[model samples]
Target: MRREGSKAFYIHTFGCQMNQADSAIITSLLQREGYHPAENENDAGIILLNTCAVRENAVDRIEHYLQHLQGMKKRDKGLIVGVAGCVPQFQREEMFTMSPAIDFLAGPDTYRTLPLVIEQARAGIRLASLEFNAAETYEGIDPVREGLISAVVPVMRGCNNMCAFCVVPFTRGRERSHPFKSVIVEVQKLVASGYREITLIGQNVNSYSDPEDGHNFADLLDAVSSEAPMARIRFTTSHPKDISEALVRTIAERRNICNHIHLPVQSGSSRMLDLMNRGHTIEEYREKIALIRSVIPGVALSTDIIAGFCGEQEEDHQATLELLSAVRFDSAFMFFYSERPGTLAARTLEDDIPEAVKKRRLQEIIDLQNSISDKHYQDTVGTVVEVLAESESRRSSEQLMGRTDTNRVVVFEREHYQAGDRLNVLISSATSATLIGRPEHGVVQH
Candidate 1:
């Protein structure tokens, strides 16, 4: 179980919340086998890259990082280099050929077998574990918490929907919910450990269902809130078509559930939507948003928007802009589309959108969202909302930063406040992306 005389490993994660949750599981597994977490790559015996392949830019960054790790390996021969998560799942043995410095490669489903792989790597064996496992949830594995403020707990894995631009279905495989009891147990543990927030993560969290236990996402949310009434509960990346009224109702009923939802609507035109195989039309997505707002009044909404796709036209871009004006999301994650390798789009469609056009469209989306976000922030000025203190403000040490239940960042003057305290903040100033506040007289309880 020992990696030479050293037992430290550092995992650098890329991609989404699912990958972050996977990194936590890997940390716990390695610790159980006597591996300590290294502070940095140079301090570690093993340097693990938990990669992403959703966009080509992320893959490019990984390739650059690999070169740095390889240079470090040349100076220190004892360092064990490895790659995990989505990138390795797709690239597999090709990654080994590309980066000979890597000693081990483990896929998202193959993390549990990593200890054996580490042993093989110790014996100078280059190893790769890229096979998919239908029933592996890392069920009994308890993730080691790195911080006490907030934690990402994965309730499920994989994706069943094959969005033409998506690489998740191929990398993470079909959807599978973890055992319901195990999920509740982890929530209880996090609450007991003084964590203030928990975001249930998955490729598409709305699809969580366990037929044997007769439990769905709504049931799980109820159980978690019932188990840890003081912890702020949240979940992310809900599929537009699958988001239910029951889920929205559950949030309304619970005082601790965050009043925010991130439902990604990649395109606004029906033609473009069908081309991407998103499984939901613009009208249907509009209905889901309407339902969510009806159930939970004043709930902050956010979305993901792609500027260019395989055959995106000027009319399609105009349609997307119109949708932005209509929805007026509090915030958005926007990207100029990049077709991923091994995806349906890559195999069947041509990436014919000119780069200049994609960039222009993306900038337009950004400008529009910025205006909407500014209006939302200005509206919040003079309102008093609860904020869980997360850390010192990056802009100023004299201030502390936290988030409102709506998941908006609010920075306020630090006055006898700590990292975990919940404060009633009086919103005083507004920016496009942040709200500046001051602590009010009364405390806000979770």
Candidate 2:
């Protein structure tokens, strides 16, 4: 039976860049089946929450969001409420029990079955498709991207790392790289379509290996840069152990590759790292960081830090703080640990840290990072940096907002430029999070 409402769909994505890329693929698949994009939930017949399972609060947020959707379903009888991505894969039938409005559940690998699931849903059938596929790369599937200035191409899927605190291995399954030729083709297509920046995304992008040519992540990066010389290339979420010398060298040599690397060192203590099953110790991670900095001068380094983990001692916390002071990351994503279920940490270790202590440590981490970020941004005063103007600033349309090659946000007064125009800007003032600048004297629009 056909769905009994307008063929319009809305996806509220809540997660990392991988989820955003998945939403794009979902949009492409549904559009092929004649479904139009809806501006919001009220105007759509289908609403899918692409959820995350990394932290407990993320799942809680999605559950709370789903409970509020009951009113929308009451108003539109034919509305098909669904859940996709890591949350569905992890929660399974519990998602339906927790949120009764959900019509179907689809895992990361089962997105291709969405159209069929919707058809079954219209016939009063509720179901969950949570099977894992080792070889589902979704090759040749062109994403329906909305960005002209920047776009993300998922070069690979899943993770093999399986850190003790993470649920990705269970939710996203094993690592699988997209075919090399298909990835290059996607990059070429995006460049041809006028995309200025292309980010090759994955759970752990450094582990990407071409199935056909036995090529590695560095090889794939070299190929992408060679194929799309006009477009700037970037990648994310590199594992500390997987980062190779070749990868750092490739970034240094490639003129178009952005000079930013987001390498997540979850904790700073070697003992804490061992408890977390992080594979690499503090010394090894620091060595890798030193290597990256030496190879690529003036590279912007960012990281992820968890303040409190299972059995985290005060000494461990101090170690993280000391690491922050020593490394002085340009920025960081810091949070108190939220134990995820079914992970090695949850099953084996006790969530022993007191809530008060956790929050205090988190705040300390935040304050230290703020000061470090302030000093870094303040140093940028009177320097010239290249920025790709993305959109009008939120404060005023008279000002334009963009990002530097180091991934720093910059806002400057609007001149004759538009979105996607790359121009050099001379930094005049700055906040901890943003750089206020004006066009440079020799501004050349690319």
Candidate 3:
């Protein structure tokens, strides 16, 4: 496993929590093969950028970064540069042509072969491992996690629902859930190792079903909760159509499950929903939201909204605004539609919306979300919330930063507290993005 130069490796990850988890797994796999982590890119013999292709800008950023890396490769002739994850998967052989600095390409399901690929690259070989493995869940591999307080454990990989504007289904391949027992074991290990919070993540998490016994996502959640009762549990990127009543009740019943649901309603217009092939109508999404609210009162709600989709009119944009106002989401991840190549939208639909119109519509969505989020935070100013102290505040070392069960960021004075300490904090002030608090009752037990 030893190379000629620095055996230190560095991975720059882009995109979602899933990609972060994938990077951790990649680190673990490489570390097992005697590859140590580099403190930074400059010190590494191998540098892999785990990229995202959700938006055109993300791909542009990666391309720009690769251009910068070209100079570094020239400086160190033995430097192994590779691109992994979505971008490499989507781009395939074109990546090598696009970025001459890149020596190899590894897709989302291709990390197991990285050691061999790197070795080949060192021997003057350029290659790609982009084959999709429907059965590859990396079950036995332990990810070399970076953080101490919270970690993301991917419950499943890929997406089955091909929303026309989405690139996930094509990039990550078909849906496959990790073994039920394996996930529980991972959670137990994390809890035993003193990690306080775990997020079970997937592209479409609500559709996860164990291949062994056909146990659904709710069953998996309940099992994880029971396995690690002390650790807070969270899951993300739920498809609105797949969120069942059983799942809602499971969240309501479980004491450890955090009271937050990130249901992505891509567009508010039913016509737009149909165009995207989202598989759910606007009314159905609303009903699901209402059911969730009714079951878990005060549940912090978040969503993803795409503005200016194919054939979007002013009326459709207005409908989206109306939905935002009606739902009043605590937070939102909003973006203008970017037509991903090889997707249904790119193939069939016309990307007719003008760039200026898309930007304007996206700005309106942002403005509305900010107002709603501000109101939500303002309303919580007088209440006390349990905060899991994650790390020192970015602004000041004297303050500790954490998050509420509802997934709101909270910052409080650090009075002999450490990263994993859970504390009850009295909300003193608020911003749209953060809650400033004072420790109410010192450290909370469980």
Candidate 4:
């Protein structure tokens, strides 16, 4: 499969862990066809943008990069550019017209045919495959590159919960879980490859139910933990209504599962919740959090919150602030609502939230989260925590950065340690976002 010239490719990934996993698959496909990975876009023969359509800002960033690539193509004249993921799925003809430099457009499911499409593009043909499929799964392909300590494995594709503001149901199609045996096989392979942590990924992870054998998400978690040799397990983007008692109990019993949950409470006001069609009220979210804490003591909780929606009033905004204060999450990913076309919200609701008000409310949410995060980290001072070394610190060469089982960042000065070592760190200082620590003892070599 080797080509004549030194064909190299670079992928710029944007958005959630699901997008990350798709990029990995695309990378694997390119490598299998004898393309080397380029360190940067300027030096590559091919460039691919794996895009996200969740936020308008993300779309803007991709367009900016496409403009830069267009200029680069004028200089090189041989660069083959492609667009993949949700943006291409949502905007096929528009994306091609928006950037004439783009040579191929492939969606999430069309990744298996990417090598062929790349060949076609090289032969002066524009290719696009945005069709959705419920039966396609790339479970057997080995990723060309993987992180040393952690990796994300997507166990399902698409979403069934049509949250009014979300375009995922439209862009990604219906929900389909990968076979349980296939998922376990992937986890086992990852463990054997020296990956210590694995995060099961999906658009709605908790809603994953095996149609073949009736094994639900909780059942899959228990099965994977029991069979796989990995040290830690985590999952993301859980819907509030889908969080079950059995899942909480399983987390409490499993010693290897990480004690962190990323349940997204988009808004706090009951009216706003109903408007968004999120299928759960604020009280239900609180009850779910309480159940998790009661079953698994000291569990770390994080969330996603939207500050302003179409018709959010001062009272609704206040409710969001109060929810933040009450939850006191370890961290949160906050954003101002941006309506996307083809979504329920865009079709039904008016985009009436003023930009200035949205910005003010978003800033207030950020400020409150900063205080809560600072308090949480400060309380961890002088406590010993286990950390998996991820990489060298960005600021200092003498320091190594890693994350605890609860996903808190720890920066420590340690010599003779590489990226994958698991070490015990004694916290010396704390900030809102990171903890400064030193090795409690000698670094534990893997």
Evaluate all candidate structures by whole-model CA lDDT and list the values in order. 0.90, 0.91, 0.93, 0.87
lDDT of 4 by residue, 1-446 (tens): 22323488889999878888888888888788788788787678898999999999999999999999898888777788999999989987688988888999999888988888888888899999788887776777776656668888888889998898998997888889988988988888887888877889999988888868979999999988886544678888789998999998998899888899998997879889999999988898899999999999989999988988988999998999999899899999999988899899999999899988999999999999999999999999999988889999999989999998899999998677778888899999999999999887866547
Model 1 Cα RMSD, Å? 1.7
Candidate 1: worst-modelled 10 consecutive residues by lDDT:
1-10
Task: Say which prediction, candidate 3 or candidate 4, comes out ahead on lDDT.
Answer: 3
- Collision pairs in model 2: none
Q: What tens-digit string does per-residue lDDT give for candidate 1 at 289-349?
A: 9899899998999999999898999999999999999988999999999878889999999
For each candidate in turn, the TM-score is 0.97, 0.98, 0.98, 0.96
lDDT assessment of candidate 1: 0.90
Clashes of each: 0, 0, 0, 0
Ranking by lDDT: 3, 2, 1, 4
304-378 per-residue lDDT for model 3 (tens digits): 999999999899899999999999999999999888999999999999999999999999999999999999999
Q: After superposition, how far is residue 156 of candidate 3 from its true place, in Å?
A: 0.6
Task: List the pairs of residues colliding in candidate 3.
Answer: none
List the lowest-lDDT window of 10 residues for candidate 4: 1-10
Deviation from truth (RMSD, Å), model 4: 2.1
Which scores better on TM-score, 1 or 4? Answer: 1
Residue 217: error of model 1 in Å?
1.0
